[model samples]
Target: MAGAALPTAELTTSGRPILLPNEIECSLLSNVELEPEGSPPLSSSIHLRSSFLILTTHRLIFVSDSSAAAANTASYVPLASVTHIFLLKKSIKSMFGSPRLKVQLSVGSDGRVGGMGTRSIVATLVMRGKDDVEAFVDKFRQNWGARVWEREKESESASSGSSLVVESSASSSGFDSRGMRVVGVAGILRREQEMWESTDKSLQDAFQDLNALMSKAKEMVMLAEKMRLKLLSGPSQAGSSNDEELGSKEEMQDWLLSVGIVSPVTKESAGALYHQQLSRQLADFVKIPLERSGGMINLIDMYCLFNRARGTELISPEDLLRACSLWEKFDVPVMLRKFDSGVMIIQNKSHSDEEVFARIKLLITRPDALQMGVSAGDAAMTLGIAPAMAKEHLLTAESRGLLCRDISPDGFRFYINLFPEIRTDDIYLVKDQGIYATWIKCASSPSRLQ
Candidate 1:
């Protein structure tokens, strides 16, 4: 079957194809089928059925659109392998059937299609959804003709040659052409120099007006990514670097990481699939931050971080909310949760309330906690989470009867619930072995009440 022959594409946890460097998705079409033509009555299993076809600058990716996620798979046909794109034929049979187009592919002697091959085969893309087939075909042809991947390779070769020249001469002179000391890797420094020299005129033009800046946004993002990578590798390359140099590199890394989204999925690019694509992208983006934040983060905080990374293609609150809400439909590792206090957060699916509650239980049982109830800020520090998030957890624990809240001039605080241990019939009665007895000893101490 063609399924065994085609190259498989790896998918993110959210079912989005893992994009290659410089690869950008240009269009999305759902309910499409890819069938290899000119076969000896090919079996049904050979065709990719009812899939979401994504057109990128480098490939045509087909991901199964089945309701059963475990049954889904993905594959791709690289544009480099495609030799010709056939236009739709004007025939009576075509007028009534699903709109389709054909692509000629180069197949190797090893019975697989690829860039350099000895044989040829035809693959038909059958459009079963209500998408503009003509428009998709036009985009397909444009991307194929552009050969962006090939051009990127050529640029890299040229940049590599320039990098070698700079490395040989950089030791002789510690400064760049503009008299700035070399900071990071010598290879990257040389590329930066060449890039700036080439774009100096464009940079001057871009700053004169808003329209110019808008036009040059892509270039600026590219430069930011280069700097970010340089900073990332700086610490590893720093053998005997001073603390000041290290500090500056760290500061720059943080700024660049927060400000650069090399390729953000935009409404202009994904069209009808904007929120779906955004949801997948966000699912992938939040994994690292979620890990650093102990498997959860405030929704508002996420909105800021996501927008900051997106740079010029900032999404609105409504857009972010819509994108997050779509996560329920997709099989993603992260989920959106709302507490009784109306605070929303994005948390990993594996995050457990019981684990958080256990930590809070341990924290509140201490002698100081027994003398004076713990505030949200105190819990925040102990739990290593945001104060607002800690408060939400505290309130949730309170509702569960794990703890009790007290409001006074001192502040709002939470103490371990002693109500369950207290004797209701007699105010003076206390269990000698329980938390109530412990609280009694602590509350009666001289320094605690004063």
Candidate 2:
């Protein structure tokens, strides 16, 4: 294939492809090779031996595990351009090694891979990894034959037509003509009662069957979003509502904030690239929550939040950990970190312990805290991290001579580092304006007040 005008697919920061509108990823296979039977240029760029193959509804995408290599070598073939898919020759040889899928594609007059042309070439998909080749082919064929893009186009046009007709009818039939004329308070109350009953009945009918609920899931998400917007627009009055009611509403709002992933990565859906795809999705999903939590969140908490966002497609703890670990391989903004005590956290790459230490310094040096010191939980609240993580940070800051820990009958606590500021040569000479001086003043002021 020569200048066939093949479009290069753009990838996310985490190396996942930017999916086209309505294009859902159907399957994936790693360690795949694209061998062109007739073209030599294919032997150069499209060869992509031992690459990761991703099958979408609209395109066949290949990516390299290495980010640098992928930038230069990654490419895709449009399903629309595929002329034919050859049946895999299953023999004794195929059972022993990797499986292969051969498909014919239309090329350009100059022999280039493209969407439309006269020339053609046969391309083979060699799955070097142990994968179910037959199932992949079935999915590929199903996606190709479905022509989902065309169906989506037709559905959009139909929806537009239907919406226009309904709007026109509603405009022509005003309140009086629509059988519900606004007369008085009693009439308004009756109309509102009728509307509520209609909505309740619709919800009852919608949830009657699994199939109906699945069909209405999108509508539910839109309705949740509308409610969330309304809540945000309303007046903020913390004392106006009871505590339990407010807590439940806040929890509901959190769920409605991120309704679902639309298409979550699953082992059945992504196959060999499940972890990779899930990693990218998790990276994108955690940005907002991580920012809200001050650039870090407990892994256990993230597990709950992530699964809630995934709805029915819940990932296991192992899957979440693996996905978080894969962030190191990609250029993801978030990274997984484990403390020496085995507590794990998901944090932004740019997040710094120095920043946490600075906040801790400010906290412990407070007028009240300087008298009694700060506990791990106190640091956690100020830093917006787990108590365990905050303790680890405090210990680290202690090691770095930024703080000092004291264990007493009262409790475990941390004080602003004054060991370095204290002069051993002159025990009674306290610095005038240093943290040491502040500590001396705080330590004596409480006695004076007593």
Tens-place lDDT digits, model 2, residues 1-450: 321244577776667777886577878887888877764665444455666788898898877656542353457888877889999878999888678788888876765566457878777888887777789899999998988777888989998998897586556542433566456666557656776786687688779998888667666776678778866664375557777777878787876777666667889978766887798889888988898887988899999999987887899999999999988877778899987778899999999988887788889889888888899999898877778778988888888888888999878998887888878899888878888888888888856478
- Could you tell me how far off, in angstroms, the CA of residue 434 lies in candidate 1 after the best superposition? 1.2
Q: Give me the candidate number with maximum lDDT.
A: 1
| CA-lDDT, candidates in order | 0.84, 0.78
Model 2 local distance difference test score: 0.78
Q: Which candidate achieves the best TM-score against the true structure?
A: 1
Clash count (model 2, backbone only): 4
Worst 10 residues of 1 by lDDT: 38-47
Query: Cα deviation in Å at residue 351, candidate 1?
Result: 1.2
C-alpha TM-score for every candidate: 0.85, 0.77
Instruction: Record all residue pairs in model 2 with backbone atoms less than 3 Å apart, i.e. clashing.
Output: 1-111, 1-112, 2-111, 2-112
Q: Score candidate 2 by TM-score against the native.
A: 0.77
Estimate, for each residue in 190-276, the C-alpha lDDT of model 1 and write its tens digit: 857777777787778779898889768767778778878877887787789899988888888878766555678888677777898
